[model samples]
Target: MKTIISTKYIKNTVLAAAALFAVSATAQDADDTSSPFSLSGSIDTYFRTALTTSDADGTYAPEGASTSFANQTGFALGMANLIGTYEAGDTGVVVDLVFGPRGTEATFENDVLNGIINQAYAYWNVSDKTTLTVGRFNTFLGYEVIAPAANFNYSVSYLFSNGPFSHLGVKADFELSDDVSLMLGVMNPWDTNDISLTGEYSLGAQLGLYDQFFNFYYDSGRNGGLGFEVDYTGGFDLSDSFFLGINAAYNTNSETETGFYGAALYPQITASEDFAIGLRGEYFAYTADGFDDVPVIGLTLTGSYSKENLIIKPEIRLDSWGNDFEPFTDNDLAPSSSLATFAIAAIYSFD
Candidate 1:
């Protein structure tokens, strides 16, 4: 929380801007354009608690959490998301905005900009197989998204938490055939909301074959940067009610000799029209020259129920670092290798 950029003054400014955008999305477009403009978004909240006992003063109940978001104990608010789009002919503009704890973490610049804009971009269809996009957009390197309603599991994976969340750049997408596609771009570093003080840049690319994708990112800098990464993310439907999701990534900086590698599997089953269950199992590690590798494994079980626009998810998770590391404290407040926690979240979407 110490790193958060929000303050009382900044918060009020964001709220006012959101209200103005909402009104324009609903009322102003009618007189301005012949193309239909659209608006949509979602809201989420949750309550989480560690199943294990903590230190005497309870200073670190969820410090053992290996990923990001939904880590805070007790009741918490996720975020309020809003998206507005205007399309005409083969070109369009999109404005996505978010507010609250989750939004603050994702953009990392809403407070500085005096608004909650997460992505503001425009796209043009140059041909049947080629298109161009400019400005900020979510990262293309991961399976999970920042939107809570779009993901089956409420919490994200360590790979997702460590990898870039968004990019500020211009990208071109190409469709070579029915099953093959590609993307390439140059950007202002990974997860960067504003161009760096040094005016540095990065490279990004993705190759897609059917449902699978291979993503790559490269930055030349060594300090305070993500030097390089390659990722594979995809999923398959095995049966009418069974599905499998896969994600893996490796990151390393040759100049700095520091890196990490991780992989995760998701298996899910639909039990009924309103109920479904899923599990995520992941193995993650950190590595450096002249140092031993530190590895950890995590497993999560979640059940989801939905009716119309409302979805409810209940989850249980555990993380353990083997003999290589003892990152948690047990019931007796002594060093241990594992921790357990539980949470339930509610999400509502509107269009």
Candidate 2:
């Protein structure tokens, strides 16, 4: 049978494959060391095939239904952090510099400059219970995150990272107890330009419990707006060799124009020390005053196997969005009512 493919998916697949290959080559030339100046990286690649249909196309069939061969891929590379000691070890200073290709860069036109520096930050350990960080850093919110497998759910939930990438400012984290902590910071809000907006700023705080089994974050900006997020995670052991877990989050912001909020539930079963299976379901919605609200719903089934130096994952996903947003069409404008997509992906990690 013949298969159809979308140009966008094809391009993404090729890029992902290239990133994976680069990571593999680099890892083979590296050595593991406990020295402060260490290096580590991982590569991910996947082929996404979709079967699309519309009423205008008559009977629903797989023929000519966009087959994305090797569509989505990427990689991440990071270096060992330096923790500087001061005053007879009474205070410690930590610095981290990280960069990566593919997803890390805003654009991937030329391979040479595609890997831009994504993170460069410093931290000061004020005490066992308090620490301060400055410079560019990832936001501390949500139960699921950009990190692979750290979240039971596959893909990204609207509540987890769709809003902003990083915050450039100062932050303080304080531990209230073994299971509770708090974080507060001030920075430019969302996608604001590096320069301050009329001396405007965004203030944020997070309350976390038990390594983030539950957490809440709030950000208030000078522009008469507020953003909030809540996350939760829980797991139970079914037997000696099997366990199940769930993760979920919700986010909302009041800028009054196209704000995002969503939730996800994942049920995972561990088959062994290095293998697992899971199902993920999520719903996300974006609302704006002058436009129709856009809602996206998706489901994914995933499986993985891993060992000392190799890890592999396979997943199938389906997504549908409300009419307000279009999907894969010539028009770049958001749709008005509905769109749907199906995809399959795989990844391999080595060190």
Candidate 3:
């Protein structure tokens, strides 16, 4: 798809942001009391292919799959991310930019270079326990993140695919106690990072709890009267080298009476400092008033190898449907009830 914004505008924005970032870094270096500004990010690329013979389009995944990072069977650029962070006293800011296929798809629904920015936000510490943040920021809903370096699996879950990616507005976070915290915010309508087409806003909140072995996060939000979504994420350390994580989400749109609900489980084992293996199992269903629910289950096995600043992830995924509600393409030139895919990605990150 064509970009909504012109190339000249994007170029101008990039130049302006670069100048601002340079100024901030220099000022921070000159100020004894200010925290240092940091530049860090990652670049990722991958080769993905469908293992099944049924895919005629060379894309084996189901329609509307969230992690459609490598739809075609070939090598693809995942993303190149550039993040700048600066903090001084009680004020801080984060500027994140990205390019490539995954970045464009995740942040702009496949619109090419509409704007290469992922997030630009600033925060102020109102008190020792409270902070107020404004501008565009990643959503608090999912356990997985947009950054490939942060995820155990290369592909994203259905739950993450359907939830909000970022919010444009203001929010306040509070540390309620040593193990509990809260966040509340008002954001532009769902999925519109730059503007609210509806001219309406959404309400967002999160409750979190954590200790040595367990962490939990719960969040819910609504876009005016349209609909609401809730998500929960939890993680527990099963052992020094083993961990378990869970995620569940539900969303409903009042106008269309359509929505989806799903959950996923992650189990990971770290064999050493440089190697780890993980599994993702998920079940998802789409629902409406009179229609029969279409359900799908997905399983993915992934292994990651780390060396210095580079990490390599190799993954295999299989998806199946209970009924004949087939949406996957197979080489058979007919709708298929299942699909299998394999991918390997390399992510290089530095600061």
Give the candidate number with the greatest lDDT: 1
Q: How well is each residue in 267-311 modelled by candidate 3, as lDDT tens digits?
A: 888888888888999999888878888788999999988888788
Clashes of 1: 0
Deviation in angstroms for 259 in model 2? 2.2
* lDDT tens readout by residue for model 2, 1-351: 111111111111111112222222221234752333322344444443333433333211123222112223333231211112111233323322223332442212222434343334556767888877666555454434333423333344444545454566778877788767777777776534244555556666765554445545555662467776565554444555454444566666677444656666655666667777777677777666777766777676777666654445566666566664544331233322333334333343332
Q: Best TM-score goes to which candidate?
A: 1
How far is 114's C-alpha from truth in model 1 (Å)?
5.1
Error of 1 at 159 (Å): 0.4
Clashing pairs in 1: none
Full-model lDDT for every candidate: 0.74, 0.46, 0.71
TM per candidate comes to: 0.86, 0.65, 0.85
- Candidate 1 per-residue lDDT, tens place, 107-157, comes to 875435654778787888888888888888777777777777777789888
Worst 10 residues of 3 by lDDT: 2-11
Candidate 3 matches the true fold with a TM-score of 0.85
- What TM-score number comes out for model 2? 0.65
Off by over 4 Å in 2: 1-34, 53-101, 105-115, 149-154, 191-198, 213-255, 290-292, 322-351
Question: Which model, 1 or 3, shows the larger TM-score?
Answer: 1
